[model samples]
Target chain A: MRRFFAAGLTLLLVCAATALAVHAADGTVYGKGVTLTESVPIADLMADPEAWVGKRVRVEGLVVDVCKKRGCWMELAGGENQPAVRIKVEDGVIVFPLEARGHEAVAEGVFTRIVLDDGLGEAHSHEGHDAESCRKETRPGVIYLIRGTGAIIR
Target chain B: MAGSAPRANHRVRRWLRVIHRDAGYLAVGLTLVYAVSGVAVNHVADWNPSRVIERVERPLDLGDVRTDDALVDAVGAALGIDTPPARTFRATADRLLLFWDGMTVEADLARGMATIETVRDRPVLRQVNLLHLNEPKGWWTLVADLYAVVLAFLALSGMFLLRGRQGLAGRGKWLVGAGLALPLIALLLLRGGP
Candidate 1:
């Protein structure tokens, strides 16, 4: 009975610690050069992507997804079920936190639109996918982008 | 026949013991690594067991060279990335994908904002889980299979380590029986009734 009780206690403690660790890992702050300031709603900017293209803009939205390969880009959740806007940053310069998923972020960058071509070997590397899957999914499409220079993962 | 050699059975048993002991010694380090990572990975719902990725915010000023090659060159120069990307994919009109050996970059053409996210290993845990996950495929798979065979040998030889009171014929019988039965009991209790 004593051994059984001890085992039960150990199990309970382990379960609690696991939960605590996960909570602790949940919070990610990508604070460096990116600072949140005077951003418009993502929906508003995306509405006139052509007008915003080649123009610097700031937008705020909840992050629905992030590139798992590199924190190079993130998709901001759209308002009213609109498609999320993809914000791209130069790899290694301004990396968004992968853990920043489900958090809100304010991004300052150029709002631009591009017609992607299949000349690319692989598809857009989005949310944790292997290269094969990405290659398969790689197809020509139009995308709205924020050339994000600074971003704050709130 | 070779199989009919006088003490062939005894010789074979001796060889098995030698092989088991040496293989067990060699596998001890890997076993410990996987054992620790296994516990951590089993509760993946509670946490991420592999891949420690980090991101940071930084600024860039692009001087209008603006051509695709020049952009890649300029960004590579800015980041001080010694090697050029293996492939660069234009994902969208403004977004560029730069693929490196193990690193990647997403660049936006409209604005010169660059976000660099990199994969970092979590000290020993990353390597541990790599082995546990059998990540290094090809030759490593064969090696892992050999290790599995060795472990089976260890368990089997362990039962015969002693004789009479401690050997498989005696107390070892009960211990081994329980060891094997425990898993079945767990499976039935956890999966059968439901």
Candidate 2:
């Protein structure tokens, strides 16, 4: 009886460990897990982004690109033909991994718009990418940026 | 009085040895962890210490796929995936990006070429790096602070560990001076740049 119980317990523990590993393989959170219950679609936010500016909102989309150097910012895919939005976080505060590029992410942040100087050609210096990299704009002069607080990528 | 002074000096040295031995043992594991992670992170410009990224390019004949959905379907089929992509982006007229968990596909619609990138964590090193970077910064900050204090105690206690030849009063002082001078010299030389 004792031997049978021991064998059954070992099998149960093994099964539990395997289940956890499988679950953990799917998701990773940076900074904090998203708290906003409702998330706005990227298309809606892009339609009239000025209305959403300064408002704390949550958005969910597939991560199309991430900052290769510092993991500081990530570009999330919007609608099929629409432009993606840049979710920028503080350096070293929340590093969105490069592998997270293909994963779905729910991110919460305040949306802010920045106007660029054409001559100086400053393209979101925090990203450390090429100057033309902040091309996720629907318009020519303005850029939509989210000061991200937290995110969950799965 | 002379004997007492020497005895007091001996007692202080004995205590230093005891504290140094205990702290040294306690610091060994964390010291090794920080030292290894420090070297790895120091050269982060060259490589990602926590994750390994692999890229492959293959000739993918996506055919005459016009719509975004059709393009994603074709790439998924080529990549041996049954599920639809998590997201798709039409980066340009010629370039399309398909994203999935742990994988990304960048395709050139005009050239029929696809570049796939996949990423995976580097196991124990990833966790160690996180600790060293203080990524988990709640209770860990306190722990790290305590470790710093222990290390300081070890360094100060260590200076008095020996007596004459190999001790701080002898060649040990030169060794310590050299250790400190190297970093100062490097800073003086390289501080103007990176």
Candidate 3:
């Protein structure tokens, strides 16, 4: 009886330690030292037309929304046209603050490029469809898309 | 029957130990993969740690929207496609749209400018991310669900694998407590305000 208890206890500790190690490593690699360029204070990256266009700079803000599926994209607090950088979270990296939309966050990635259709520029154009579908057909060099690895949300 | 019982009990215990240990080892790597991917994906608004950079350039003229058909033909020619364009439209007088490869292309019809953008799917990470998200689908979802249950089992069984002062009752318990507390504290801080 005592031996069984001991074995169980050992297994538990190992598992816990493994979990901690996994979390620690992920946090260090993905959340420690990332920066972005853009000082806009809105939630939608498309809202701010000038601040984000044709520029590469780092900005700090909050995460306003996240995708439930494969975490394809996230929204920030910059506004409609000149919002904070909309992050395309890498497929396998795990981020913190899973559920809170209004949480303060700091992201570091390139302000590359994005191009939206002129017709869908109006706010009400995408009423029933998902937001991803509303994005204008993505063009190559016409828009800036940020790509980064590290983020911290307080 | 009584004489055979001890041997059967011994055999069962041995098999249990073997299954438990081997399963634990097999699960360790996958656990890390899922756990890391899960946390990163949860906070999608935060940032992407593993992003690949890509660049594309196409030479074309954007001065005339009426010549857009020629532009598409040129693109199709460049891509070595002989089939008629599945569909074509103008995103703008300056921008021409082309559809291919389950993706869309937008180009400047007048300026000879073309931009190609596609979501970069990280190699192993993409599949791991799918598993972590638990998308309700075919066998993958079922496997993920099973992995979740196994993780719970591993966590519970792990507590017993150690012994004495370093075991669950001592240092083990402390470590577990700390692990649980860290997330809880973060949650509390995030909630803020009464």
- Each model's TM-score? 0.43, 0.71, 0.45
Q: After superposition, how far is residue B114 of candidate 1 from its true place, in Å?
A: 2.8
Question: For residues A21-136, could you state the per-residue lDDT of candidate 1 as single tens digits?
Answer: 64356333232334555666776776776777787777776665565544567877544345467777775455555556556666777787655564543334431222211122
DockQ of all predictions against the true structure, Cα-based? 0.02, 0.24, 0.03
Predictions in order: lDDT: 0.64, 0.79, 0.54
Tens-place lDDT per residue, model 2, B24-95, is 987998999899889888877678888787889888877676777887898889777798877677777888
Regions of model 1 farther than 4 Å from truth: A1-154, B1-20, B26-51, B59-65, B73-87, B100-102, B109-112, B121-139, B169-174, B189-194
Question: In model 2, which regions exceed 4 Å deviation?
Answer: A1-29, A32-58, A110-125, A128-144, B1-5, B64-71, B79-96, B122-127, B136-139, B192-194
RMSD of each: 19.3, 6.9, 17.3
Model 3 chain B: ten consecutive residues of lowest lDDT: B46-55
* Pairwise TM-score winner, candidates 1 and 3: 3
Q: For candidate 1, give the lDDT of residue B155.
A: 84
Tens digits of per-residue lDDT for model 1, B57-151: 45556687767788788877877787987656544567665656446666665776776656556787767766676643334467678878878
| Model 1, CA-based lDDT | 0.64
lDDT of 3 by residue, B1-194 (tens): 88799788567656656767977876887788788787766755454433332436666543333466777887666655577655555444565556443334556655666655433556776656655664323344566777778888777767666567887888999999999999999997886321
**Candidate 2 residue pairs in backbone clash:** none
lDDT for B123 (candidate 1): 81
Candidate 3 C-alpha lDDT tens digits along A7-120? 977976786577557546634234334544445443334556456655544455545444433344555554222334456555445443223244455666656543444444
**What's the i-RMS of each model?**
16.4, 5.5, 14.7
